[model samples]
Target: MRQSGTVGFWRWRRNPLKRRSDVVEAWVLLIVAVLMLCGLPLAGVLAGLHVDDELQHQREERQRTTAVLAEDARAWQAGRYARYQATVRWKASDGTEHTAVADVGPESRAGSTTSIWTDGKGELTGEPPTEAQAASAAALAGVLTMGGAGALVLGAHWVVRLSLDRHRAVALDQEWARVGPQWGTRHA
Candidate 1:
């Protein structure tokens, strides 16, 4: 009984070669493992990007550009449109005094305040992701979802095939036993 138990336990252990039900099962498992491995990182990356998008959307929806009453636009150089800078004061959600060098197209008037939001660089800016970035992120999410779903399907298929193989093997052995005596004339 101990010997039989040992044999059974070893058989039950995970073995790559012993687990294969057929060519199909092997192929399925291989495809699933590869796709899942690749999809894990992609899913993480997409999830991070999704969080960034959500944060940006929230910021855009909640923030408003109120005119700064106590601030003025100060140009650092003449004849240089892009090099112009200004100290603009803005109030945040927590009522913190956020000050930044505001740069709009050309230069802002001394008393005018354009809409802006705080970005990851700790700079209040007025730009968002272009259409190309959104399209690329959407494409990446779709690809990851498809790959993960494919992996899950293949894994399920391999598991079912293995179970069916075991069932059929037992049934075949029993059928052989039932008919063995009719053709049995052993020379030993």
Candidate 2:
């Protein structure tokens, strides 16, 4: 009789990874993972660009407002409590120079430049815009947007991968079934 051990070894070598279909499935899953890793951050950034509060801050730069340095301790304290009058010079997008009185924070220093925004009621109010706020808002928006986009991308990719893997598994099972009788006989 032929050596069963040698025959079994030959059969195993014929399919190293179990099936060629397995290789395909692995590739599909890998692509999905990569896409998920990339997409979430992109979505986050897109969303952040449209944030209303941050946009308002940016637009206020064009509005005119009054700016005053916090003078004495009392004035500073009062300025902190009640929105004090501040004079600010702001340029419109059209390049027109304008000045207006607006409410500002006491943290505003003498000669420190700030943008003033006017309310719909023609009353100007708000803290003197600081580089810190602008920078902070921008950073926050960026981080959030990126994070969201990353999540979205990851989710989508995972879903796609899962579907592909399921299909692959089904196909692999069918193929195995078809080959099963032949392989089983050989083994026996």
Candidate 3:
């Protein structure tokens, strides 16, 4: 009698009808399982560590300093956000003066003092991320990396499965062609 349900480990068991393609497919599934369980998480952790290190380095290189607005800071609307832009001047660690246009508080006016971040060259730069922000960024990086890797692995597995299916279909068709004539003659 024909089996109504699938047999467990049929691919690995010694069956007369089992083809080489079945063995290959079973091995593919095993490898995919291993990668999903172990390899993907390792890649995610490495990616997160790399992002955290880079962010920490950037935070270390940034310097906070007080600057005086050289011109009145005019508030402007940008989409859902509001900002005040004005020219500001500050002295660098080398005692050289630098002037640039930057964003300031809405209440800031000419000659008002404000805090700003600068790079080692005394060029105005955005403030680096805080510890919390860096941690969040690292976590986001890790999750995204894991998601991307998982997608790639699953896609590859799908392709392999599709190819195996097609191969099995062709083999079945060839076998049917070879045996069908004999059965027809016996029936006649």
Query: What is the clash tally of candidate 3?
Result: 0
* TM-score of each predicted structure versus truth: 0.41, 0.43, 0.84
The alpha-carbon deviation from the true structure for residue 91 of candidate 2, after best TM-score superposition, in angstroms, is 23
Model 1 bad stretches (over 4 Å): 1-59, 62-90, 98-116, 119-128, 186-188
**Model 2, 5-108: lDDT tens per residue?**
77644433446556554555556556655655655456555555655456565456434543333331123234435655555555444555656655555566
What does candidate 3's lDDT look like per residue over 38-152, in tens digits? Answer: 9899989999999999999889988999999998988766665888889999999999999998989888999999999999889999999999999999999999999999999
Q: Rank the candidates by TM-score, best first.
A: 3, 2, 1
Badly placed stretches (over 4 Å) of model 3 are 1-8, 78-81, 94-97, 185-188
- Which candidate number has the best lDDT? 3
Question: lDDT of all predictions, in order shown?
Answer: 0.62, 0.57, 0.93
Give the clashing residue pairs of candidate 1, or none: none
lDDT of 1 by residue, 105-145 (tens): 34466677666666544346565655566556656676676
Superposed Cα RMSD, model 2: 10.8
